[model samples]
Target: MAKIVVALGGNALGKSPEEQLELVKSTSKSLVALIQKGHEVVISHGNGPQVGSINLGLNFAADHEQGPSFPFAECGAMSQAYIGYHLQQSLQNELHDLGIDKPVVTLVTQTLVDKEDEAFANPTKPIGLFYDKETADKVSEEKNYTFVEDSGRGYRRVVPSPQPIEIIEQTSIETLINAGNLVISGGGGGIPVYKDNNGDLHGVDAVIDKDKSSALLAANLKSEQLIILTAVDYIYINFGKDNQEVLTEVAVDEMKKYIDEDQFAKGSMLPKVEASLQFIENNPEGKVIITSLEKLDDALEGKVGTVIKK
Candidate 1:
């Protein structure tokens, strides 16, 4: 059986809780199909929209005297718990219906980041709700929050997007995976944390790219395959242009050259591509699968998606 780490993209989730649960029902079916075929799967997902909405709601409540203030890290934990709950429930039901004996578990994981990572000095990741300029300035002044005007949509809170150096609970995660458990973990690049002088971990206000975290986890777990589900069915060069070309199977050397070309967009396919590179670099024997969630069958059959390998 192949040990696979499936990193779900934003398309796997919905904007609201009710809708997200419904979407995961279908996602579970696809995942269970892999399990039935004798492949061990580990699931991880993006929480960009979910975490932002959660942080916004909680802070609003706290401001209204309805609850205690929640830091971004706490909100990250909350997002992981609830998302894992939904994924766990759906996977259990799906496996049960299929008469599979595998159990699903979600770990509220933490990722360690460098305290002096240059990203800390430059907080570029935008999170939480968008506010009017006046409101943003007021909040910035009162709460010491950084606000950036987001393409005229409105001003939004920005946080550091640091690199994930290590997965703190990797040993536990590997243990669970070894026991044939369907593990969901490293949610939203994990709650970013830093170690102090005494080696104690402290939570911080930052966002680590989920794609990078997924790659890190897969490499650490030593999985044979890392499947990244994005919105596109395949990686394309000159995307959205007349001369665009779809990449089917790319060797590590060729992929490195393609990565150097300005074909992939930074905010979208670039991170996914970069993460795939990291996985391949770290685990030379392993390969990566990148495609849309909608193309699961074809991707699994090697009829679609971009396969990166050494």
Candidate 2:
């Protein structure tokens, strides 16, 4: 049995609460399979859409005098609880059905980020509900927000995506895992927090890439493997094109070259590959698999997916 940190993709989790529950029901089966195979699983997941929806609803309510105002960081915190509850419920149901005695727990994890990180100067991550140009401008004016037209879908508020340096709740996570519990931590890349001069932690108005945080969590736990379960079956060069080619096994140096060539999309696969590189660099003996949740079984058997290693 090996210690593995698995980062579940946000897209795979579904966009709405109702859909998320249904999707996670199926997701729980795959995860329990890993447990059946004797892997110690530490689960992490992205909350981009969930957090954005929470923030947007909060803002809308506040604007309409229906609810009190809340900060984006608090919205991130709410999202962690919201998503975690669903996952915990679904995982528990599946485990009970299989007569598995493992306890499933969701920790409201916090990740530390550098306040002086260059990412703060450039806000590239988009969030919240999309709006028409006029409405976007109006909301931007009222709320003093930054909006960018997202791939012609509509305008969306953008936020800084800082890198995660450490997982604050790692000790607790380790304890849970060592006690034979399946733990879910590092939600929404850990509510993006920073330490003040007084060494007090405060939430930052930013998003930390979940993949990066998952890698950090894996490194912190000294996990033997990092499995990123995404929508893609395999990482491919020139993805969605006629010249596309799947990468079955990638060495650190080779992946770095591809990254330097800008072969991956900045908003998509790039972060996953970069995170894979980071985890491999930190834990040279460990390996990372990038594959869809549906193909997780095959991927574990080395029949499908891209595997990154030292």
Candidate 3:
């Protein structure tokens, strides 16, 4: 059986609480199918919508004096725990229904990042709810927050997206997987942290790309395959253009060529491909599968999606 680390995109977990729970139920079912097929699965998921919601809630509450405000790291932790809760419950239920006796667990994971990472100097990762130009301008002026128009979807708060240097809970996660339990960790890029001058760890107001962190996790765990479930069935070059083409299979060198040519969007498929390359570089024998959650089974069967190898 191949050990796989599945990285779920933010879209796989819906935009709201109700939708997220329902979607995760379906996601769990799909995951259990993989288990039935003899794949040892470990899950990692994005929290773009969830953490954004939390940050917006906190901002609103603070603005209205309804509650005290918390830091970004705390908000990230909240997203991780709640999302993990939903996954644990749904996966356990699905496993039980399939007559598979296994424990589903989640760790409140933390990822170490460089204190002086260049990303901090230029915040680019968008988070929080979208706001109209007027509201966005007002918030920016009053709160000193950075808001950027995201793909013409309205302005959103952007934060530093640092690279994940290490997974603090790597040992525990490996132990759980080794013990035959399905594990979920590294939610919202594992709560970005950095080391202080005294060599103490401190939480930072930053986001880490989920796929990037998942690649690091998969490499650290020595997993043979890193399956990244996104909203698309395959990675495409010239994504929205008429000549756009889907790549069914790609090599690391070819992917790097496309990346150098700026074929992928920065905050979208680009990071996913970069993560895939990272994993493939670390484990030359490993494979990275990129596909939509709905087409997971077909992708696994080599009928759909894109596969990247060394």
Candidate 4:
């Protein structure tokens, strides 16, 4: 059985807590199926909506002076715990129903990033709830937060999207996986961190792309496949256009060419493809499968989605 790292998109998780739990129940079934197929599973998930909700709640509390101010990193950790909690409970129950006994654990992971990354100078990753122009402007002015209109869906707080240099809990994660456990780690890009002048690790107010972080994690673990579950069934070129084409199978170099041509959208399919390439670069024999959660089984069986290989 192959060891697989599955990177789940935040969009796949519903917006509200109730919705998230229900969606995760379904997600757990899919993961259990993989386990039944004899594959070892390690899950890493995006936390855009969850962390945004936390940040919004913390911002509201801070605005009202209801409690101590919570930093972005703290909010990330909170998101990770809540999300992992849901996954752990759901997956465990699903495993029990399927009569497959296995231990599932979540690690509040930390990912090291470069302090000199250019993204730090220009924060572009958007988070938190969307707000109208007036509210957005007020928050930006009062809190010195950078706001950007996201796809005309109102304004959102933007932060740096840094590259992950290392997974701090890589050894622990490996140990868990080696022990035949279903591991979930690196939620919200593992709490973005950087080394300070004293060579001490410090949590930074930044967001790392989940796909990129997952790729790094999978490569470090020497996984044979990196499965990225998103909202789309397959990677498409000329997306949204009438002439849109679906790519069922793509070579790593060919995918890079499409990226150079800007075939994918930033903050979406682009990063997924980039992460796939990153993992393949680190592990030449590795492959990446990009598909929707519903199509995961089909994708694994070569029935659907995009597959990138060296």
Question: lDDT (CA) for every model shown?
Answer: 0.85, 0.86, 0.89, 0.89
Reference-based lDDT, residue 160, model 1: 85
In model 3, residue pairs whose N, Cα or C atoms come closer than 3 Å (at least 3 residues apart or on different chains), thus clashing, are none
TM-score of each: 0.88, 0.92, 0.94, 0.93
Q: Which stretches of candidate 4 lie over 4 Å from their true place?
A: 130-143, 149-155
Please, what are the lDDT tens digits per residue for candidate 2 over residues 186-304?
A: 98888889999999999888878889999998988888999998778988887767898999998999999999988886655888999999998899999999998778778889999
* Candidate 1 vs candidate 3, TM-score winner: 3
Model 3 bad stretches (over 4 Å): 130-139, 149-154
Candidate 1 lDDT over residue span 204-290, tens digit each: 988777889999999988889999986678998877678989999999888778778876755457778889889989999999999
As a whole number from 0 to 100, the lDDT of residue 283 in candidate 1 is: 94
lDDT of 3 by residue, 218-272 (tens): 9998899999998889999887788989999999999999999999866668889
Candidate 2 lDDT at 60 equals 86
Instruction: Provide the clashing-pair count of each candidate structure.
Output: 0, 0, 0, 0
Clashing pairs for predicted structure model 2, backbone only: none
Error of 4 at 170 (Å): 0.7
Model 2: per-residue Cα lDDT at residue 240: 64
Pairs that collide in candidate 1 are none
| TM-score, candidate number 1 | 0.88
- Report the lDDT of model 2 for residue 78: 90
Native-referenced Cα lDDT, model 3: 0.89
